[model samples]
Each structure stands twice: as structure tokens, then as C-alpha cells.
Target chain A: MLKILVIGATSLIAQETIRHFAADGAEFFLVGLSADKLKMIQDDLLVRGAKQVSTYELDLTRLDKHQELVDTAMETLGVIDAVLVAHGTLTDQKAAEQNVDITLRELNINFLSAVSLLTILANIFEEQKRGVIAVISSVAGDRGRGSNYVYGTAMGAKSIFLQGLRNRLAKSNVTVLTVKPGFVDTPMTAHLKKNPLYSDPRRVGKAIYDAMKSERDILYVPFFWMFIMMIIRNIPERIFKKLSL
Target chain B: MKRYESWTRQPKVNHQTIVPLHWRDELPDLSQFDKLVLPFGLGRSYGDSCLNEHGILLDVTGLNQFIAFDEETGILRCEGGVSIEEILKMIVPRGWFVPVTAGTKYVSVGGAIANDVHGKNHHTAGTFGCHIPQFELWRSDRGRVICSPTENKELYEATIGGLGLTGVILWADIQLKRIPTPFIDMECIKFRTIDEFFDLSEDSHERYHYTVSWVDCLAQEPQLGRGLFTRGNFYDPPLGAKKEPRALPMIPMPIDLPSYAVNPLTVKLFNELYYNKQLRKKIGGVIHYNPFFYPLDAINDWYKVYGKAGFLQYQFVIPYKETREPIKEIFRRIAKSGQGSPLVVFKTFGDIKSPGMLSFPRPGVTLALDFAFRGEKTLKLLDELDRIVFENGGALYPAKDARMSGASFRASYPRWEEFADYMDPKFSSSFWRRVTSS
Candidate 1:
């Protein structure tokens, strides 16, 4: 049985991911910002085969309370087998570019706060010497594009940080995984036009769970994002800059 | 935008699709543009009830938002575009379920009320409108108004099963029922004949809250009407723990099947295997509410089985007081035509009164069948069945009727003239135009 800790438990992707675990009778300590919503999910998870579900309400951007949330979950689970950081927002690049205040706030919520939580969990996992740390990044992090560079820059920094964590935690046997889901159809992306490449949130949830179980260091959901991102990355800066991609 | 098709995939037509982003957002006034308009939800209607040919469609699905809900009392106020599936996803874990649901949960709340859909439990619960205490009706003429059984009583009765001609339902308030869990204790039995079915159904109805059957429409005179009857009740046990239902991954239809895939021989073979699948005379077990109620939902886009030509679902109810001769006659005609439908459902409707003036269910035995579209041949066979059904004082469900003679409809539903007075002059559908025109 997996003793998992899921942040942003109310998110559609996170909810679907929790469903996969609950069906297997896993114990979960769920953290979110809303008490009522969290409790509803707790009841839902209980029905989904979760051995036990404990919910804590704490806004992820409130870095001051990160320690308290982690301490309570650790006490409840004793030793967490997996720490899934599924919190982040799809930033509006145009807004971020125009407003420094918005840019910093996006960085605080999407990158810095995640880095803060990861640093804390990595220390606890370092002592345990065996735990998986997974976080949701995007294929956009593979390169800076004019369409979404402001948000892409933040995710890119975190992806690089995960690389460093994987290198540092390897000796301690604590695996750091970076999950780059291509284009999952969730509430977050419901507004965007979809095509054949769009993935269902449930399937994306299963893919992430499978990657963690297999202890993969880097996972590109649907497997096509890797090739697509690779091509985008290898493009010459001259042509890329000239194009409106 | 691509042209949309209903579940049957028949009457394929083009229309401008409009999705409102907010409740107060103005819906395009059809009178201003001189365009016929119909509100589209999930497009689960088996026919043209949700479609407007060569006009405009106000896709109100984007207006989906629950206005308010009292969880303890299970009274919910939500936007009409919200699907029954979405409501179930929210309330089921809280130990509550829809009071009445059709064979599928994909229908929108507005759609359910508009169709006045009935289910296996219609014997006790009546149709969907019986559970919908009130809703907000937004007509171009009346604007947004609160319509209920008590308030705007005429509109309330007309809008239920009014086929959306009454107006677009902006939001609905539904009354849900409490249950112990989402699991149902189900039992299945095999009956050899219609007489035997009546006896079995009478006995089962006394014991189970839900009962329906699948009959072999292809059977000949000697073996005719053999079927498997299924009854279920919400499984009750100690409530120390809640068990959530798990669904298998939905398998979307990869491609359209060949049009010739569903001939009489194939239907007969499938029915035989299905009828004999349970070797035991009686089998009972506990299963999820998903499979027990919405079996086809597990298979996404199961409609593709009908191929490119799509299909037509013929459903009718002849009063129990009428002789069984009409049913026997209708089946005889269908079998003789060599167009026996692969999916045939049979059920008994109890004395529960429907609130809708145009509601289809009555005290009767109902049979619903689906036939692949063979154009004029299929229409002729359906017309023959319609005559038999109407002559026996039965009516066809307007929600499922793609093509029924106006004379047959007028004969079946004598309240049509009274109901027609309330129809919104600015509202119409392909179905209304098809059935009401001379």
C-alpha cells in the first residue's frame, strides 16, 4: 500500500490521480485550500477504495504554513512513500509580461513555493533514504516560446531544479521524477481548442501513477511530447525568433 | 464549427452553434435574425428533438453552474445545461442519487424535464418532472421566469414534455433521494412467454423497486416474447464505511461499423446468446449503479453500431387494460419484415401520474426497439406499428419519435390542442416541424 501525500487535491488532474490510488486501497493525506471541498473529496475517496483519507486546508502559496502541513501528514502516515506536488497555475504570459507584480506572483505560486515544498520533502526523504518525489511540469518548459515564455520560464527553472534534485538524491535512493504531461483535457485547459493530441485527465492520471510505480526519472505523458518537444528544442534560434511560434 | 448530430446520428443537418459564457449573457434573439433556434445540451436525444435544421443552436452547455444545493435535504438548484452525470458525480458520494433517471445519465437536467423521461422505477417514482419541483423557463416572449407546478402552472405543465417548444429551460431545481450507497443488489430471471412475463413482472414488481426486461423481438410464434427480466434495489448494509463505485475505462467507438452489420440473423444470434447467458433460472448479485442503470454508458459512443445511416428507436406504450393482441400483432409484423431490432426493451408502467400534460407513460406495458435506418422500408414498418399502438390507445414518446404520422400522434395524445396553446411561438425543433406539419 502507498502512503501518498497529494497537494492541490481539489484539482481535476489531482482528483483523478487520487481516484487511481483510492481504487487500490492506498492511504492518503490530502491538502487543499478549501475545507468543504476537501471534505467532499475525502468522502469520495473513501468510496473509491481509499483505506483512509485525511484532509488539511491550507493555501499552497502561504509558504509560512508549509511546515505545519508537512508535519501533520508525516505524523499521520509515519513515512510517506510518495510526495506528489500537483499544484500550479497556467499563467497568462501576456499579463505577466505587462505587470511585474503579476510576474512575481506567478513565480511565487508556480515555481518558488513548489521549490520550498520540494526542499522540505527532499530532506525528510533523504533521512528515510527511500521515497519518490514527483511534480507536474509541462512540455513548454523544454524551450522558451514567444506565446508563453513568461510562464514557460518559471516551469523551466523548476525542471532544471528537479534535474539537480535527481542528481543529489540518487546516492540516497530518493528518486526525483519530472512529469511533463503534453495537453491534458482538464478544467485548466478546457478553454483551449482540442485536437487528436489532447489527452483525457483520467488517462493522464493513470500515466503519472504508472511512471511513479516504475520509478522513471523523466516522463512525457502520451510519449509523443518528447519527440514534439525535441524538435521544438533543436530549432535554430534565428528561425525560431523570426517565426511567431 | 462542425455540424452536430444527435445520438441516433440521423437527420444530419447544419446549424450555427452558440455557447453562452454567463447566465446574464444575452442569448441571440431568434426573432431578430429570423432564425429558428433550439437549445442544445449534451445532444443525447435519440432524434431531432435537440436539433434545429438550417437554423441556429444555442449550446447552453457552457452555462452549466450549480446555483445552490441543500445537501441535507438533497434539493439542488442548478443550471439546466448541467448533465445528470455531473449531478451524480457530485451527489452520489454524499449518499444521494437522482430520484428518476432514464437508461442513460448523459441527458441534461433541462433535457430530462423537457422529455419527461421515465425509467424502470417509473412505476413508483413517475417521470423526471415529478422529481423536478420547479425550474426557470427563459422564453423569448416571457423572458426569464420562475415556472413551477404552483407558479406559472400552465407553463410548468406545458414545458414538461413540451419538446422545448415551450422555451429554453435556463435552470432547474431537482429533488434527490437518499440511499445507503451507490451499489444495487440486482436479480435476473428468464421468462419463456409474454403471459409468463406478466406473472413474473407482477411478482417482481412487488419485491423490487426497479424492474425491466430485454425481449427477443426476433422470436417466432412458438418461442415469441422470451426475455430476461432484471430487478434491483439499492443495496443496504452496515454504513460503517462507504464504498465508491469504480467505472471501467470508457471505450469510444473506433470507427463506424458496416451498415450491414445488424441484420436479422445477427440480432437473433445475439439475442439467443444473451437470453441463455444465465444458465440458472434465477441469478442475483450486487453491482454498481452504473451498470445496473446505464449499461450502454460504459461503452462510449455505442451509437456507432448503427453505422453511417444511423438508426431510429421506436418506443410505445399500450394501456394494460388493452388486449395483448396488439403487442403480438406488432411483433408479428416486425418479424415478418425481417427487421427485428437487436436491442428490444420491455417494461411495465405503474399508476404513478406524470405531471406533464404531454407525458408519454401511462398504465401500460411499454416496448422500445431500435432499427438501422433503411429509409422508406423502415418508415413503413414503423408506421404499421404506430397504427397498432395507437389503435390500442397507446402513445409514442415525443422525445424518441423521429417520424410518426400526425394523425397517429393526435389520436394518441388528445391533449395536443390544449398543449399547443402554450408552445413558444419563437421556439421550435426539427422534431416538431416533422410531426406537426401536414
Candidate 2:
């Protein structure tokens, strides 16, 4: 019996991940931005066989509310076994490139806000000495391509921070896993044309759920993205930057 | 705001807009508008039954919610927008299954009821509407009302196969079938002709809970309707272990293929290989219901295989007495046309009365053929088949119908006026307009 907390519970991928847990009667605490969507998911999770489900509507970027959201989750779902951090938006590449304001906001939502919550959970898990903290990092973080360099930069920073967190928490038995998904078909990416490489959010969510069960530190969803990113990462800066990816 | 097509992707029309609605939220008041409004679910109805041409389509896929479930009795309740896939994923592990399901699990409950869809197991269980005990409907003329077999009976009968013209279905209470395991004990047998198929079905229907066959429409005369007949029954695993619901990986077809990709020659060749690929004449295996029921769902965007032009699926059921001669005639006409569908299905239907007034299934053997849109040539051929089906006193299923004429419609469903009496003035669809007009 796992007691889990899902932040950004209404996101397509996160909702799918919660379904796996709900099927097995896991207790849940969900936090998302939309009140209507949160209620819908709470009801859905209950029907899917979750033993208990509690939801809170909060804007993730509201720094002052972070502590309140976490405290409520911890109190509602006592002895949390795992925390799935699956909130983040694909930044508008053009908007970020032209405006610093847009770039800063994107960084706050994708990296800073998540780091704020993780910092709070890391300490809680550290004191408890048992818990898994899984965060979603994009494959765009592996190596920045010109097409989406700003989004890549924010994701890259988040991945680097999680790497340090995982290393530091190793001795305390608090496992931190970084998940890198590539081209998931979701409302976030609906504007872009889909290709053969695009994977369903449910499939990606399934992979992420499976990865957390094991003791893996870094997981590339769909698995092949690891090799694809490895090749992209190894490319020379001169040739890579010259051509559009 | 943009133009859209039916599931078939043919005759793209400019729609007012597609608003993917969440049923929990207050529905927008469309009474102010002059355009006819219709509820659109997963858009899986291969024909115009799901389309509101040049008008507003209230996209209802987002209303999916599981409202209630009684574990002991296997009775379930959910929003009409909930898909069969979502229900199976939740209940199958609990040893409960949908009483009836379509070829694809993506169809919404509203669509299933609207079409009165039937699956291979229809020989025993009947249409999807049969298991539905009650449903709530929202109409412009009549705000909201609950209908069922025993209560509000006329509306219930009309709304089931009313093709969404009656109103928007809010939620439904369904009685689910209990099963020992999620595994299906399946067997596939080869048959050379429609007569052999009839003989085989007569025997299989009593032993197995579900039965369906696939005919190679391209095969001529001596081998006219050669096919693989498949039958299955829910089986309990040997030990105490229950099978976990397995979600198959869906690899997408990235783009619309070239028209030549699925032309006559290729279909014939593929059918030849497919028939022979079943090396053993008869084979038995224990399998999950996912692959057993939904073979096409294994590939995401499989409809794209029909290419940009899209394809039409013509499924009509003729009574048992008229099965053989008409089936052979239809097969010969298809083979001679040099147009073929790689996947052509023939199945036995039991003597079950449809819960919907316009329901398609009756006591019969039915054949469904998919034909690529070849413009006039295709229309002419379907008209010929339509005439045959009409003459035999059989009806065309509105779910898979796009081009059924008013005369054929009248011949098939004499009770259309009975269904029309309860029709919501604010609701209408492209199919309804086409079938009942000049």
C-alpha cells in the first residue's frame, strides 16, 4: 500500500501516472492549478479504486503557498511513500528568446518553483529516512538545440539540480530520480506537428511509474531517448549549432 | 473555426467550431444560434451520424468520469463521455467486463448508445444499449430527463439509436458482466465459403460466448468467401491468479499514406498472405481480451491507413434465410470491381430486439466491407449493394452508414417516425438530414 502525492495532478502525463497508483488502491493527495479539473480527477481516482484521495487547487508559482500546499499534503496523507513531481510547461521558444520577462517566468515555472517544493520534500524525506522523489526533466535538457534553446536551458538547469540532490540524499536513503521524456503527445505540445517519434502521454507515464519502483536514479522514458540524447550530447558544438535541429 | 471530416475523413466540411466540453461545467447556451447543434464523442462513428456539417459540434470527449460502481453486483455508472477503455482499465482487474463492446475501445458511452453498437458477442449479449439500464438526457426543448427500459420508455427506445438527434446524454447506469478472468480462450478456424461459415457458426454460437469471421472480399467464385472464423469464451486461469489488464503499446502512423498504398492490388495481395499466414487450419490459445477484441487499436492512427481520401465501411445485416445467396452475390460484385478491403468481416447475429428504435442488428448473418473513396464509382457500387440489402428486408446500420438513401432508410427502419416523434428540435446531424431528405 503506497501513499503518494501528485503535484500538477491534472497534467495529462501526471493523471495517467496517478491512474496506475489508483488501480491498486493507493492513497493520494493531489495538487493542481485548476479547481474544476482537480475535483474531476479526485472523483475519477476514487472510481478507479483509490482508497482515499484529497485535492487542493493552487498556483505552483505562488511561492508563499508552497509551504501551505506541502504541509496540507503531508498532513492529509501521513507517511508518504513517494512524491511524483510532474508539473512544467513547454515554454514558447520565440517568446522567451525575445523577452527576458518571458524567459524568467518560464524558468520560474519549469525550474525554480519545482526546486522550491523539492527542497521542502527533500528535508521531510531526509528526516523520515525513506521516500522516493521523482521529477520530470525533458530530453531537451540533455543538449540545447537552437529550435528550443531557452526551454532546453531551463530543463538543463533543473536536471543538474536534481543530480546534486540525488547525490547528497544517497546516504540518507531518500532516493531522487530524474525522468527525461521526449516528445510526449499532450495539450502542451498540441500546436506542434507530431511525428513517428512522438509517444502517448499514458505510455510515457507508465514508463515513469515503472522506473520509480526500481532503484534507478536517471530514466529516459521510451528508453531509446537515452541513446538518441547520448548521440545528440556527443555532437561537436560547431556542427550542431550550424544546422537547425 | 476550422473545417472537419467524419471518422472516415471524407467530404471535409466547414464546421462552425468544435468545442471539447467538460460535462461538469455548465453547458454553453447554443439556443441563441441558428445552427443545429449535436454532441460529438471520440468521433468514431465511421459515418456522418457523428457529424454536424456546417454547424456546431459539441465535442464531448472531456466529460469522461466514473460516477459509481457496485463491486458485488457488477453494476456501474458513469458519464456518457467516458470511454470503454477507461472503464475496462478500472473494472477488468475486479473481474467485471462491459456486457458489450465495439471493435475499438475509444468510443464514448454516448456514441455507443447513439449508434447502438454491436460487437462479435452480439449473438448472445446484443447491442451496447441492451446493458444500459438508464441514462439522463439533455435537450433544448426538454431541459433534462432520465430514461430507461421501465421508465420514460419511449424516449429510452428512441435515444438509444436516435443518432444523437434526441439529445445529449449526461450519464448512464450500466449492468456489467462478471467474468472469471481477463483472459479469453480463443480458437480460429478456416472456412472456404459462406455455407461453411453458416455451418460453423451454428455450432460455435452455443459453445462460445462470442463468434466472428473475416472474409477475403477479393476472393472469387470457388473460393468466394474464404475466411478465418474466430470464436472465444472467457476462461479462468488454471490457478488462483487473475490476469492484470495489459495496455498494448500503440505505435502511430505518422502521416496519411499515398492512395496507392492501400489500392486494390495491394489489398488482394495482403489478403492472400493473411489467409495463408494462418498455417494451422485450427489453433487455440489463451489470450488477453485487448488483442482478442481490438486488433486495430494496437496501432494508433490506424484510420490514417486509408490515406487522406478516407474510406467508407458498409455493414448491413440480412436474416439467416437470406444469408447465403446475397452474401455470394455481394462478394462476387466486390471482387469484379477490382476494389477490395484487406479487412472484411462477416458475423452471425442472434434474434435480439434492439433497445433503440433504429437499432440495426436482428436475427441474421451480416457482412461489413470497407471501400476506399473512389468518388462516383464507389457511390454507384454501394447503391447496388444497398438495393440488395433493402430487397432482402435487412437494414443498414446508421453507425457505419454515410450514404443510405431515404427509400433504403424507410425500408430498413419502418419505425423512424416513432423515433422522430421524440426528437429534440434543437438537435440534428448530417446523417439524419441525408437519410430523411430529397
Candidate 3:
């Protein structure tokens, strides 16, 4: 059975991805912010067929607590077969743009905090020589748009970091995967208007599970997002800057 | 603006705001919101019951997480937003099954309870609410009320089939049926006349746990009520018998086929082919539960076959009066109109009483048909059928109703006034507003 460690275990996408693994009788060490939410997910995973589940509560934004979480997971699982960094906040781009504190806090949670955990997990997986490190990035990272540049900036940084991590971990056989999901109808996007472009979280979750199992370096969930992002990325900067996206 | 439509995709309404409840503990402070809010699940209700027009919709799907399950007793406690599909996936491997399941598995437990949904096995098992021993209802006024048969009995009865107006069902405890395997032993018998259909149904009711029929509504007088009668029970295999579950790959129908493509001529041909597809007069086999219960579900978004204008599901149950004349007259009108319903389900609900005050099922014969929305033409036909049903002391299922008169609703559910007393003042729905106000 695979021993997996999940950060942001309460996040909808993470919970769905873990459900797929749990059905295979995987053992899990989950870390999230809310103890109540964590406990609920722990029970859910157990019922889904997880052999064992243990949870720790700590806000991911607290970069200082990163090491303790990893140490606790290592102690619980002995050797982690996979680690999923699946937690992040969707900040209000308008508020983020107006306030430096808000912008910095958003960056801290979405970029710095994830980087902190991934950096530590990368070392442990390197020493172990066989494991997978998967992180949930966003398609928004592919290009900065006027509508959501603040959130895009943080995800863009995380995406670049994962690219380098994947390169270094490739030699050690510690597969690093970067999941770029398009508009998913999760709680984070509850306020946003949903359209045909918005994919269900379960679909995105299944894609993440499949990508992690296959050890793919990069994945654009729904596959169509790959082309969508490609078109957005190729647009001329002058033309892109003039149009509202 | 994002407009939410029911499964039929008709009468789309825009909720003022959609608040997603992700965790059970993280329920929003409903008191803060002045406007009436209704908890919405998978939006499988065929019509307006699931819609709130301009009111808030508390999207409970995110709160879909299992709380507890007793393997020995086959009792499961899970968040109300959990789908039957999810429940089956979790419990089927453990030799358990939902006591009652509708034609589709996409419906949330909350929706099932609110609608008091019944199924093919309803003759034996009753409504889905019958299996729900207890659940937590979160109201704007009363924070959390645990409703059951003994405690808060009125609220419990009112909440079931209360049309999501009573309150939000947070989590529910369901008593699951213990099955030998995930397969069902099914038999299909063809009947040429309404009398034969009734005879077959009456004969099978005592033997089969699940019973239903598919009628070709477009057939002429001789074969007017001609259809196939199917009956089944949980597959009980020989000792040490090995079972391999199989499910048909879901074929997604196009988002919208042209309205003209699904007219009477095409529907008639399709119905004819479907009826004759089974060459043998009788066939029996062990089949997986998925296809057995949800034949239409095998085709994802099967409603799209009705076309871009969308369709309306008209399901009504008329009390048995020792004759099948009411049903025949109704079928005669539909056949005469040449409306050509591509799908029609006919079943007889048994004496198993439901716990809900406003539950649709009773000791009656129920017929459900889908009509493509074609302006006033479809409405006129249904209105005529409603007269027959209402005169016969039948009730239109609120879950499947898009347009039933206020008088028809009140006449059908005599307990609606009593049920109104238990409804949360801050909870309302489009269907409720339309039927009650009129």
C-alpha cells in the first residue's frame, strides 16, 4: 500500500484526489488548517478504503510550521510514497492590487508557503530515492491578465519553481508533477460566474490522480486547457494588454 | 449571469447568490442573509422545485463527506449532499445497497429526502425517506434541529418532501439494504394490452422486490398500452458463486439536438424499434445494478435528446379504482395528439406508506412521460391529462412538475397546509412561490 502525505487535505480537489488513492487502500498523513475540516476528511478517507489516516492542524501560511508537519508525516508514515501540495487561497485581485499587505499575504499562502513545503518534501524524497511530489498550480499562471494578475503572479512563481524541481528530481527518480487546472467549480470559485469552461472539481481531481499515478511532469486538466493556455501564451503582449480577459 | 436549470433544462432561474457550503462545521450564518435561501443539491429535480428564482441557493454539494458507517448493520451516516452514486460506490463493495433509488443516481441525498423520491422498488421499499432514520436540519431560525420519527416528528415528516423549504438537511443516517452481491436477477415480460400489463404487474408485485414497465405512448388502440414489464430482485447466487460487476460505458448525448429532429415521426420509429428490439417474449438474466435501475443514465445528459427548447417531465399517480380506464384514456389522448413521447415509465406503487406529509407516492398506478417543450401545444395536452388525473383523485409529483395549477397541487396534497407550518420562514423555492401564491 502507498503511504501518502497531503497538505491542504480539506481542499475539495485534494479530498477528491485522496478519495481515488484511498480506494486502493492507501495510508495517509494529512495536514490542513482546520482541525474540524481535517477530521471530516480523515473520516471520509477511512470510509473510502484508506488503511490508516492521521491529521495535523496548522495554517499553511505559517511557513515556520512546515518542518514540523513534514517531521510528523515522516514519523507517521515512515517513508512517504507520494506528497500532494493541494492547498491555496484565491485572493481578491482588486483588494490585492490596492493593498500591499493583502498582496503579500496572498503571495505568502499561494507561493511562499507551497514552496516551503515542496522544498522540504523534495529533499526527503531525494534521500528516499523513490517518491512522487505533486503540486496544484493554476492555468492562470500561464499568463498575467488584468482581471486576476495578483493571483496569477503567485501561481506563476509556483509553476516555475515546480519546473526546476521536476528537472532536479528527474535524476533521482523522485517524480515532480505540476497540475494546472482550468476553471474548476470548487468553493474557491463559488462567487465567480460558472460557464461551460468551468470544469467540475471531481474531473480535475481524477486528472490529478491519473497524472500522479502515471508520473507525468506537467498536466493541464481537461487537456483542452493545454490548447487554451497555448493560445493565451502566444498572444502578442501589446494586443493582450489592450484587451480585457 | 449564471442561470441554474433543473435536469429538464426548462424555466431556468437565477439565484441572487449561490453560497457553497464545503464543510459541515463551516455552515454559513443563515440569519445574516435576509432573503429566503434554499439548499440546492445536484439540481436533478425535473422542474422548478430546485430553483429559487432570485433567492439564495446554498450549494451543499461541497459538504458531501461520509461521517460514519456500520459495516455489520449496513447503516450509513453521511452529509446530505452526498450523491447516491457515491453511496453505491462506497457501500456496494461491502455488500450493501440503498433501500430505494430513483431512475438516476446523480441526485443528492438531500434532494431525495426533500422530494421523498421513490423508485422501481417503491412497492416493497417505499420512498427514500422511509429508510432515513434521522438527519440534522439547519434552519435560519433554529440553528440545528435533529429530526426523526420520535424527536421533532412533525418537522421530520414535514421536511421529507417539504421541497427544500423546511430547512437544509446537513447530514442523514440511512438504513441500507444488505444485498448478496452488486448484481440483480432481472426478468422482462412483454404485455400487449393494458389489462395484461396490470395482470403482469399484480402477479409480479408479490414475487419481485423491484417492478416497472416501459410503455410506447405513440402506439395505436390495439397496442396503446403495449410495453415491457420488468421485475427483479437482488441477485442471490449459489454458495461460492463468483460475480463480476459490469457497467455500460456512458455515451454522452449532444448538448442540444434540433427540435425538428425529435418530432413525432422520428419518436414513433424509435419507440417501435425499442419495443421489438427484444425478439423473445421473455428474457431473464443477472445484470449489474447500474443498468438495471438507471437504463437512461447509461446515456449521459439523456434529456438532451428532447432538443434545445428543453423538455418537461409530467409524472402523476392515480389511485387504483379497480379499473385501468383512467390510464387508458390518458394514453389515448397522448397518442391522439401525436406528441410521441420517446420515453414513458409506468409503475404501480404499493401500500408501503411514506413518512413524509407531502410524499407523492400512495397505493396507486403512476405514469411518467417526457414531452419536448413546444410552446402551448405541449401545455394544452398536459392540461387535459391533468383534468383526468385530478378528477380521478390523483396527484402530480411536485419533483417532476414544471407547471401544475395551484388548485391541482392543493387538491393533490391535502397536507400542504399542515406542511407549510413546519417550513422555515427564510426558505422558499420557485415552485413553492408559484404554487402557493397562485
DockQ per candidate, 2 decimals: 0.07, 0.25, 0.54
Q: Say which docking band candidate 3 falls in.
A: medium
lDDT of all the models against the reference? 0.81, 0.83, 0.88
By lDDT, is 1 or 2 better?
A: 2
* Worst lDDT 10-window in candidate 1 chain B: B248-257
Q: By DockQ, highest first, what's the ranking?
A: 3, 2, 1
Model 2 chain A is weakest, by summed lDDT over 10 consecutive residues, at: A185-194
Leading candidate by DockQ? 3
Per-residue alpha-carbon lDDT of model 1 for B231-335, expressed as tens digits?
888988656645544433321111223335687777777777777877988887777788778877877877677777778998999876547788878877877
Better of 1 and 2 by DockQ: 2
Provide the interface RMSD of candidate 3 in angstroms, 1 decimal place: 2.5
Docking class of 2: acceptable
Runs of candidate 2 exceeding 4 Å displacement = A8-13, A32-39, A55-72, A85-119, A134-245, B1-4, B32-34, B138-144, B218-226, B236-285, B300-310, B322-324
Candidate 1 vs candidate 3: the DockQ winner is 3
Off by over 4 Å in 3: A241-245, B1-3, B245-260
